[model samples]
Target: MSDKPKTPLLDKVSYPADLKGLSREELKQVADELRTEVIDAVSVTGGHLGAGLGVIELTVALHAVFDTPEDRLIWDVGHQAYPHKVLTGRRDRIRTLRQKNGLSGFTRRVESEYDPFGAAHSSTSISAGLGMAVGAQLSGKKRNVVAVIGDGAITAGMAYEAMNNAGAMDARLIVVLNDNDMSIAAPTGAMRAHLAKLVSGPTYRGLRHTAKQIAKALPPIFHEPARRAEEFTRGFFTGGTLFEELGFYYVGPIDGHNLDHLIPVLENVRDAEEGPILVHAITKKGKGYGPAEAAADKYHGVNKFNVITGAQAKAPSNAPSYTSVFAQSLITEAREDERIVAVTAAMPSGTGLDKFAEHFPTRTFDVGIAEQHAVTFAAGLACEGLKPFVAIYSTFLQRAYDQVVHDVALQGLPVRFAIDRAGHVGADGPTHAGNYDSAYLGAIPGMVLMAAGDEAELKHMVATAAAYDQGPIAFRYPRGDGLGVEMPERGLVLPIGKGRILREGSTVAILSYGTRLGEVLAAAERLAAFGLNPTIADARFMKPLDEVLIRRLAAEHEVLLTVEEGSIGGFSSHVATYLAANGLLDSGHLRFRPMMIGDRYAEQGSVDGMYGEDHLDRNGIVATVLRALGNEAEAMRILNAGRD
Candidate 1:
């Protein structure tokens, strides 16, 4: 870690209550100090940087203006909550961000009382906050609920739904739309700030309330025009007509960096008796840091780096990443088939669609944070006979399962799902783990599922998905570099529902799925030293069950094992179900075991370490095979040594 920066004001403040006694100027000093602290801590920890930097002032203003823990503060996506974390008595462990057994990169409910709601995915804050607000009112408790959502997150339909509900219910809730990148209201100047302050201020509200009472005594026809005139006048200046239409009292395009503007408006929002109020604060992502500000994503997510030079420390890679391979192979396929198109849910670069966009700008669609829409949009495209590859992370894909089943699978549309980050993503923790795609997608009838055993296999699956148009198909690949295997000149479309044996053996058979094939091969070699050589086979498609190969393995070997980097009801479940129904398990001579991710969320750490923890690593596979062979002592020895 680098030398700590001098933070005099920050040293005096340990919690939000400490800020309550300070002058506005002194609070500004705290915000400045807090910004420095976030930058320094992120340089060592390497998590979300720009978001924390962007909301430094707003974080201070909100905490200072409100009574948290009782008021209920929720940060949408939790990316902008680093400064909140620091001020909430987690400063000692701030440097341990995203580490295993340490602070989470996103808000975790168990981590702190100040964090009322945990969040990692986007656009859920408002709904949660409204629920809290309504609950508090029902309980006869005088408490405030505040949900801070980002501009990018606001694009999601969930946010709008929550706003509409809150408006109809007349819940006393506050939604702060933090406009950092998308500039929901682009104009953020003195005029906007003045109008925002005016709308939220006590004087303006009191006068408006009086006018409503006087208008109430007038004719019924005049009421609508009076209300429209008041709203239009305010919306004209604030540019928050949409929010107003949703039943919220829209406040501002206030400069988020200015404490003078933020404090007063937030104070007004706190004091107001209104049902629901929306505060629009415009902020610059990576505000105080020059290097981050200059970055394309403002260092939204980063690796550990030198604090002085802003040079991020990255590990050198000898092999190409799975995402890059997918991107290139898709580009290659698209070049041949002009009907091919790509879609991403606000993750162009993360899904490698940015590279595809460069070549085929017209073919790529970025459906901002709306995975549900992305799925159905691809379904619509496929209806026109256009090949649409919806590339989404395994975790984020959960958001669109309804659409996948109803819109794509039910309709038998040929929408190809490019499932990235297939299993056990490190550092981002369980929230980002790609462990359920196989299980969820496998359940739907006519849904063909394939997991890449290696980068080369990934290419084949991509080609296979593109070629097949009978029904909805999905191909999953892991989060990092592939097995460093030889790449095929061009991907070949494999026959549907078949698996290939990598090695042949007599005693036991190991049926592998996804990138775990590399580990399976290693375990097979290890078993060779034990004088119990095991056969290894890669099950390319999980849904089809590979009955022929599975039956062969069950028939040839005394023991059979299924291995995949997924949890229950995935590859192993399908194999077990097939084998059991065929009377394989009742043989009494052939023993079977399925190795999968444990029935719990894995903490953030090295992917290899997490795999080892779950007994899914090379050593884990070896141990499982040993125990299956009835070499109990040897299996225990290997397991103990691996853990130690």
Candidate 2:
């Protein structure tokens, strides 16, 4: 028998509506139970822990105060929505969080009515909530729209843009700034400093009394003047003048963990009929869990762990992770070159720029949650004749596409892009997947695109990018550890637009891009048992395709198969286009097959599981090869045997 926490109060309530009947004191008890439930669930599921734990009191208060489903509550980034999920009638499946076909790690509108807007990316909740509020106003509905955004998320330019628009239109939107003092990485920039001043300053406590006095003393005609005076006074004291200028009624710096303070304040805000309001609630990232609180990152994301010891279980691996390799490689390159600099957008640790920062702190720039700004800033540095390496995750690079096109690529700036998490990132699911970067970047003219086959290749590419000064160049690598290839003391810059043949054979040719080369090799080994020795080649550069090698392979081999970790319109598409344009595919002799990620959103699971589901694994690759060679029966047999 399994041991579960005793939650008599939590047992009574399944949804937010059930909390309406409970007393304030009972609700406080319910909050405690909710916290325990969240810890227990996450302990097993191994997901975002500290963010959800910090928001337990806030989550309970919001649900108890607001009529949810009717009142739209959007959580920015959704890392902190685990507690929200537990309360929104998803407790039964909480253990299955981030598993395939199970509850998503983040908020999804399709999952429940309570999640009115889906969110995985940050700084989008306020905009979404404001839209909902405006739509309600247009339809003659009086429903409340509350957007709970974290301090980290608010640092993004998108959050401020939404705030500006909401304030200008005087939209009836409630934006809860969950000031936990941290995002995935520790918060940075001037905005963080301003928020810190607001929380610690006595001005926050004095504003309410002064505002009330001004409102009471002023007559009907003097109301506008009195309000402005109040705004200036509050702004002068607490540094909330900026928020007021943006058109939001600034209302907080209160203790988010205290239900005594939280309930009444939320109730007041819920009843207010004013312009967009910004409630800045100060809370800890990890409030209750001692282990989480003591940790530097507050256990932002965690693996499955022992409940008592709080020691997370990580799978043992001898190979170094791609992130660590990239960091080390960059460090090696930076040591020799004085002009080399590193840039990241609020993800120094995640993108492995922390190591670079340790060596060259002055040279590293962490523009907080601003991808667009990061790209343009790097471009600006490049304009001054500096080699700027913009290290960012693939999904995040999508946010700065315009900057890449106009500021970097079009201008022909020699900015190096070290795109991490370049393919399917497991557990984070579709939202964090880097499935589109290849297609997006490949479409742009004068862009040099490369995918690393292994850690050694990645090092070479890093060296290649550092040396290349012609135009924008981007190289991608996957999430986990690289294949345990032999290491080089220093990386060698290979010739541009060239590929290397790994194994030479007769009947078929398997052309692979990125980390999928390992799987292709494994499939080739399996094919050898059937007396079919297929040729395997690694196309290191996707853009400026290796025409000579590809054409030679086409002429020699009966079938040419292309595989990549990216979606359609990526490396394979480029290869096919080149083949078609050159009259290679038009020749009746050559058979062509391109394998990529299927056209659909993949759910959260292990990386290998996602590849298997998409039929891009070793077994799938073997089957694809067999079927293409007019052996359908053999292909089906191989697939079925692997399943069995």
Candidate 3:
């Protein structure tokens, strides 16, 4: 038997334009095939399994009704777009999803014409979709615009902004609330409760509308009191008049899994004219997948696994991942200090705050994909003398740069930023890489930055951040497993602006930070084979620059090299700036080359694959060091050097 899925109707769909001709019965078959294909594809490739499975019917219904590509479709936080990708001509390459030089795990504009606006970040779809809608109207496009947002994503302030603006303008836009009753963790807040009431009520919508029309028809003298009474009653009955008052024709609380209800409602919304509309479709996060549905996070995004068994592939080692290490370290610190509370931007599970959330439910705050708010919220918590660990990925923290600078740094809040994914994040690609955290964070005054070389270093860094109460501090760690170094049962706080010398050399010094130390040490070993002893210094802190150790090394060595896995203005540049300013330039023929992720949008690849492609791997580092040391002949001997 062949492994190829039966794509009878799905194979026929070359574009959304072909979808309109299909009968409702035929479309239902297409949805079934799409779901099966998605499950099959994910079972092999293993990226974003649950989210795509949840939206199979909705994807079918949207394409079946709307003129996508011509009419814009923006998918919020795009993990749900695997089914959308499969339907829109990427089905064959689906098995290569999230792999190097293959289909993206999330929606991409370059991948398809159907995705008018691409999104990997959550809560951005509504705002971007609104922009497309407004732009379309301005340009006389008159095309339909829709933003399919998750209920979890709906909590962000920007979503409310788009809703408020769209409602006020009455723009011809469709806001499909894909309510799975969960974000990464279970959904929280008053807004979630409001949505629950709307879904639970039987005849509240009918009664509220009848009263509204009656109030509008009342006599002039009684208009004011009647209007006030109607407003009060409307608020009492329909829990979603908040959206209604903003100008959206709210019609939903419909079963999203049911094609019977979704198709007709989407069709009606597509045909309707005057203003913005909200169609609340109740969905299960891992609908049709029993194992995923049973999981706590609805298996929101999963690693590669066996489809039949629903078992993820066994890891090669029992070593702890950088994320788990950070979680354990933080938990240890939080236990000692009750003032240390954790905050995450709709990524409790992703950032490993879920562990913290489980232990201290009241202390862990999941701020719901609002990176900007999470930063300022931490600042607020800090103002009240609470120690807040704002655990955010480096990529997501980029979204709140202004907040970090203005709110936290300016006010001198002791916000301990547990920066996860601080280097080349494989598979999820450039969009998810934590490549610029060092440079950006270093730019702020009173901001201390550190990176971990291994799990033991990470534990100390965590303790350092917790102990520092003067200003904001951040500790960055990579995505995957640590180097299997023995972790201390308890952490020790390292001195600020201090470093340890790993190897002693006469001519050249290789100053490295974070996870790049492992590679630097490997390069040192290779150089040692050639009777070249290179001094390797582990510069623990980025901001303060470990000036004592650097100055000592710079004075003795004939050549100096700074290595970091960030961009242009990172640690290397900072070292250069400090050397130049302090008149240490021209000392030992000072060779400053930062082995960092250069200025480019990197593609999906393995860690080594991307590192080599970008020329930031250990061999690249050795080659760059050799060239800087005026040993070009020696540099050529470094096996991996290519492309100048």
Candidate 4:
């Protein structure tokens, strides 16, 4: 802690070119300054804190060593790219991280030239980076391509597939294995232990050097014997005999924190004459900072917090988050039903299965980063007469869409999907937004798709899923706090395909589902002020829709408007399809306007800010309803007598 209040060299640096003139000694000082700057920026904005903190040194080192914009660098998840953003001409916009029409939380190709490949999903970097590397090789371009992947991200099958192909192709690529010992939660599966042995354990380097020297000395007649010596030595030391088998020359288990070692090791890997390589750089999760180190997972992706105590600065919650509600409800249902089990892929706390695991340890399964396996595993469980509740984030569940369709839906297995984060998830931006689940799930035959309007309804949906043994069922809920409604102490299963009418009116009907119901109600109130009494109905089930209610409403109301937080193919489209098929499309000019998440990806921002920008909020919904009525301009506009 300097008493003079040292200004960060990193703050002054706007691009990789600015860091060019500085000596290697000065670069380390810049790294320290960048760490402080990252901490400060994330504290105010409340973005992905722990990951950015973990990669401060690595970001600095890579930029220092590699020609960034020219030499393409792809970050796996982009949660760790905050510091990279800061270094690459976006420092001033750092405060606007995740804000709609502002800077994105994840790396975007449009956001900066340095970011050649952008991602919010995990295990994609290796493939993307390898593709770029091969392209560069074919184009005869002189540039290094590096993919920095966390140990946790490496568990996904795609990363290994990329490694295997990159190795076989012998593409000029550098893979920096940033082993941080955690994902959103502690990593599961054998890959973790294997990485621990190869990256964290010593004895990785001496064998590499010895093998190279032995290969050089061997004559043409002794070529086969020399190859055997290298293989034996690799088996003796690196134990990762796996990377070698894949065709990558593995070097490391190096200290990522020490710049002395990191810079030189990176330089060597960059200079390495031929073939693909893996530099295993071991690092702490929340490095340098004491409070962050203590509770890495909590700080991993956080809201604004006090820097001194690491306490999340806030007001007391009016209601528990939807995640907590889902977890608690599942626990209660699982208690009575011995056949019920829970599953999550990589996320325990985020999906709220941490509590379920505590209570029903044996029944709860964390299947690592493999979402495809988790869904198929649930189908397997369902096959054996066990009820499997596969709790996954909506965005991640997209990875297992085929399994949900082929295995669960096709077989009509009773697998309950508790789809969390099913709407505009703030700060993480477009890549992470849970905008596709509703549409994708609804399209699968034999799948019962439901959405919760509020937390109270979420309880009912959970209970409903547990009781329903008909086929594959799913219920989606948004991220963050629930509406301040009194929660039911006892879980009661609601009737499937049934919706509740919250408010009644005549001229128009506003149909809503999931978190956006609050906006619809607000729009209804606005409509009433203008002498337009709109009927507001909470259409809870997306699939097996309340056809009876829909037909009656279309007959009664002048306009039937449907709104949901998902994409074009979601709830609204389902309503349109239903109307067209049932001869309701000819039911006069009923003016059916379906509102949903639009063509573009929703960016991270204040929940209200994103909703406003995307026209998913109260004012936007009201405007749409008003426009439909042809009474938006003048509230008192009267209809012509006997027009029809």
Going through the candidates in order, what is the number of backbone clashes in each?
Answer: 0, 0, 0, 1
Rank candidates, TM-score, best first. Answer: 1, 2, 3, 4
For every candidate, C-alpha RMSD to the true structure in Å: 1.1, 4.3, 4.2, 5.4
Ten-residue segment with the worst summed lDDT in candidate 2?
A: 182-191
lDDT assessment of candidate 4: 0.82
Which candidate do you rate higher for lDDT, 2 or 3? 2
Candidate 4 RMSD computed on C-alpha atoms after optimal superposition onto the true structure: 5.4
10 residues in a row with least lDDT, candidate 1: 182-191
- TM-score between model 2 and native: 0.94
How well is each residue in 1-644 modelled by candidate 3, as lDDT tens digits?
Answer: 29666778788887677788988889888888888888888878778877778899999899887887788898997888999988788877889999988998888888888878778878888778788888888988888888999847888788888888887785778888888874322333445434434432344446656766787787777867875675555445434566777767676466677776677667767776656878777788788878887883747777777778888874697678999999999999999999999999888888899999899999999878799999999999999999999999999999999999999999998999999998889889878988998888888999998988888999999999999999999999998888878879988999998989989887889898888888888888877766679999999898888888888988888778777788878888888888988988855466656577879988888887888776566787778777876778877766434543
| Superior by TM-score: candidate 1 or candidate 4 | 1
- Per-residue lDDT for 64-161 in model 2, tens only? 99999899999987989999998999999999999888899999988999889889989999889999999999999998899999848988999999
The list of candidate 4 runs beyond 4 A from truth reads 1-5, 182-228, 587-589, 634-644
Runs of candidate 2 with Cα error greater than 4 angstroms are: 182-227, 236-239, 296-298
